[model samples]
Target: MATRPIRMFGDPVLRTRAQEVTEFDAALEHLIDDMLETMDEAGGVGLAANQVGVTKRVFVYDCSHIEEGLRGHIVNPVWEAIGEETQIDQEGCLSIPGVQKDTERFQTVKVSGQDKDGNPVSMVASGLMARCIQHETDHLDGILFLKRLSPELRKEAMAELRNAEWNQEPRG
Candidate 1:
């Protein structure tokens, strides 16, 4: 598997909705592998296909740190609210580079999706993990975390975004 270049916020591809994956074939698997590699290379907890200029309904996240004992991936995922909407938490996006801002998200969530092998799976998540799932899945739908932030917060993050360096080097 090889790391793919992550598209930054200004890229139009990040704003466009992704297409559904109707065929789970070799190409799909390869894309997933590449996504995982990209996420790891970027030191991000998650990534979406659109982040790599591929507008497809696919994202992967590993929130083992937040949830403590749980770890996994989400493919073609959908989420349902499991609890009250929570206060805004500071969030950063690979697509947005060094930009980070406060955004509101659910305190708990129930998501359903398929595994890499095309097996159906569902799970409930809370706290940071829940917020992360919501954030990453939103990317698949062409929604950026900055969109959820207040205008002032978005403005404050602009400088950091401008100063941030994109990881253009290839990762093995």
Candidate 2:
């Protein structure tokens, strides 16, 4: 496994909705492995395939810091809000490095998807785990966490992103 470059925001791949994975193969496995390595190296809880320039529905996450033992990759994931309640917290993205905004997310969620090998997997998540799942799934759907921000906050985030030093640097 190798660390792949995390595609920064404004890259077309991040805006394009990812295609569902139909064949579970080595290429998919490689992407997943690389995504995991990239996320770890970048110190992010979650990294989507699209965030790494792959337009396949896949994401790797390690939310163990916030929720112990909460880590893995998911392919073709779908999640449902579990309750009427919501939680607002500061959320960041690997694609849009250095900018975090208060975003609202469900209190709990039920996610179902397949593993890299095409095996079915499902889980119930709350707290940061649920938030990470929602955030990564949004990437697969071409939605950024900035979209979840309020008008004022989004404007602030946009200005911040506009001037981020990383924006001028070359990405691997």
Candidate 3:
């Protein structure tokens, strides 16, 4: 597996809703592997296919600080907020480097989807794991964490993005 270049803010792929993963094959497996590798390389807790410039509904997370350390690849996932309790926490994204924002998210989440082989997969996550799942899932929906912030915060985030020197060199 290889680490793929992360698509930054302003990239059209990051703004488009990713398509569902249909073919459960070696290619999908390889893509998942590469995503995990890319996540680790970028020091991100989770990543979605859209972040890597692939318009597919797939994501991987490695939030190892939780109970048993949630780590997995989810494809074509659907999630729901489990409780009314909300948590406001600092969040960052691999696509939007050098920017962090305080975002409100569900304190607990239940996500269901498919594994790389298309088998059913599900998880009930809380704490950081829950936040990570929500964040990554938002990417699949073409919603950046910046959009979750207030208008003023979002404006600040956009300014930061515009000023930062994103690594825009073409990736082979």
In order, what lDDT does every prediction score? 0.82, 0.92, 0.90
Clashes in each model (backbone N, CA, C under 3 Å)? 0, 0, 0
Better model by TM-score: candidate 1 vs candidate 2:
2
**Candidate 1 residues 66-167, lDDT tens each?**
666565566789999985768577889887766667788989999998887788989888877888789888888888887788888877877666665663
Question: lDDT score, residue 147, model 1?
Answer: 78
lDDT of residue 100 for candidate 1: 68
Each model's RMSD to truth, in Å? 4.4, 2.5, 2.9
TM for every model, in the order presented, reads 0.87, 0.95, 0.93
Poorly placed runs, candidate 1 (over 4 Å): 159-172
User: Model 3 RMSD to the real structure?
Assistant: 2.9
Tens-place lDDT digits, model 3, residues 1-172: 9999998888899889999888999999999999999999998889999998899999999987556557888999899999799999888898888989888899999999999999999998888989988998889999999989989888988888877877445559
Residue pairs with clashing backbones, model 3: none
> Could you tell me the TM-score of candidate 1?
0.87
